[model samples]
Target: MGLQNITGLFYPSQTLGGPHIDIEDIITSQNVISRVMHSYLGILVPLGLLAGVICVAILIRNKVKHQTLENLDLHLLALVATDITIVFYSFTSKTRPDYLEVSNLSCGVLSWFFNTSYFFSQYLLVLMILILLILDDSKTSQSHLRYVFLTLTLSIVMSVVNVSLLGTYDNLHNITYCQLDPLNARPEYDFTKFFAGFCVPSLVLLIFVILIIIRAREVEMSEKLQAHGVVLCHVPIMFICRLFYNIMLIRRTGLKINAFYMSPREELVLNIAELAVFSGSCIGLIITLALHKPCRQGLKKSLQFLINKCRGKETSNSVI
Candidate 1:
């Protein structure tokens, strides 16, 4: 197959089929799918970015005013920042009209950024759970900072490996397609990403959550424990949001290996899964604002302050 043919197969709207398929019907379906995908991205990406920025601002303000920030707060800030980057990158690259013309360097860098940010966010949650498990007396801000640094460093290394293996340049076609490399070329990369990035962290999170719940039942729940409860709520939300994306990845890999064509229906499902992944980040921020009293209070105060300032300006103008 030519490069164009191969690239076409990767897209949902350009699947190969038997002669029985109607060409006009396929064109109509493709147009519909494109509209749906664009519409979804238009709404979700902006809303997600806005919510992420607000959440970050609220967290930082609370930290500044109180002069006492917990380790969980620090991790939450990092996660929000990471998610913002992910959303922004997704919006720019996926929505671009000529993504196929991306230069080799740009492709590698974008892949690296996406993988590193995503992996860092996932493992940061694991560390947050671990911090919750540790005793209050033993915890220190410096230690938590070190953990954050360590997780970032590890994520960078893993992303380097991912880019080296999966991201490739096509000299003949004079184009670089990010994440378009054949999975069978280096099957280990996909397996490693799936296991290290998703499966292992998921397993660890499950065990820690169960242990935390058992401990909560055994002892009297304090304010600190209540914060831990928020983490518990976050765990399930993250899992559900990420689950579909992972499934889509697995399915895509399977279809590629078997040389099977992807139907429009399957492609629609994958597109929805992609949206779910970004939406997960937004939902996580909402959960923190709703369940964490400090953040919720901080947001309320900020809104009230803005409202009062606007009202003051209006009154002064009316008097003039």
Candidate 2:
């Protein structure tokens, strides 16, 4: 079969046999998906870069100053790094208007990298919170190292399975981005992706969150500390965002809507869900910055140092 004919099988029932949409019309019309992705990248790319750079600098300074590295510190660094990687990958995957369309192999490769990075970030958050729930006396470097190792291993496996079986790696036509074929994909595969991508991670996080809550009450940490833990961990917030996004996907695929059949209004809602998925990754870093004092102070000093150096250079230039 021709490549175009083979590609046709990936769309939902509504679009396949229904009214045809001109490829040019799809691209040039008021495309909400493209706009949404553009806006998401515009905000998230810069934010992730700043947070990742500052966090890395903070981790480096701690090592240089011979400060003890806590488990939370290590987790924050990993999360920041993952968030930045996803942002850059997203930028690379965004559709270019004039560039020749990408080949299926290239699309699959992009999809694999993007999905794996995203899953790693989510699963890492679950692992971090689980570690936090462990008794402080029992937690140690060797143990934390093991947990990190296992999390990455599992995330890589799941990403590969989802990309390979759950759906074919193909560009979503409207967004022109590589993703598991969403509309025409098998419901079984959609369920697989949903269960693995969001459901499992969210479940693990919720269990740990509950344990933390129980421990907070048992320890009688001040109400302030309990509230602080909830805020800093930010598991509930992340879970909610993922839950909403997963629901939207389930509904769309469950209802078997054609990929191209979304009205502008439905497309807007889908765009929001896509944004939620991206935003979910950013929350962990934001919480780390907000709650981790060493990280916050280090980032502040790092920024100020850069600012001062710039001023020094400008002053010397003026004098000369």
Most lDDT-accurate candidate:
1
Task: Return the number of clashes found in candidate 1.
Answer: 0
Candidate 1 C-alpha lDDT tens digits along 1-320:
23333322455444344454555555655565567657657776667677677778877877788885677778878887987887766664364222344555565566678789878988998988877766443668777788899999999998888767652444323343344323222345566677778899999999987777677755544545865666777788788888877887778777766777666566556666666776777677666767777677877888999999999999999999
Q: Judging by TM-score against the true structure, name the best candidate.
A: 1
What TM-score does candidate 2 get on C-alpha atoms? 0.76
For candidate 1, the C-alpha RMSD (Å) to the true structure equals: 3.5
lDDT of 2: 0.62
Model 1 pairs whose backbones collide? none
Q: Local error of candidate 1 at 132, Å?
A: 1.3
Residue 214, candidate 2: how far off, in angstroms?
A: 2.7
In angstroms, how far off is 174's CA in candidate 1? 3.8
Compared with the true structure, all predictions reach lDDT values of: 0.68, 0.62
lDDT of 1 at 47: 70
Candidate 1 lands at a TM-score of 0.84
Q: Provide the TM-score for each candidate, comma-separated.
A: 0.84, 0.76
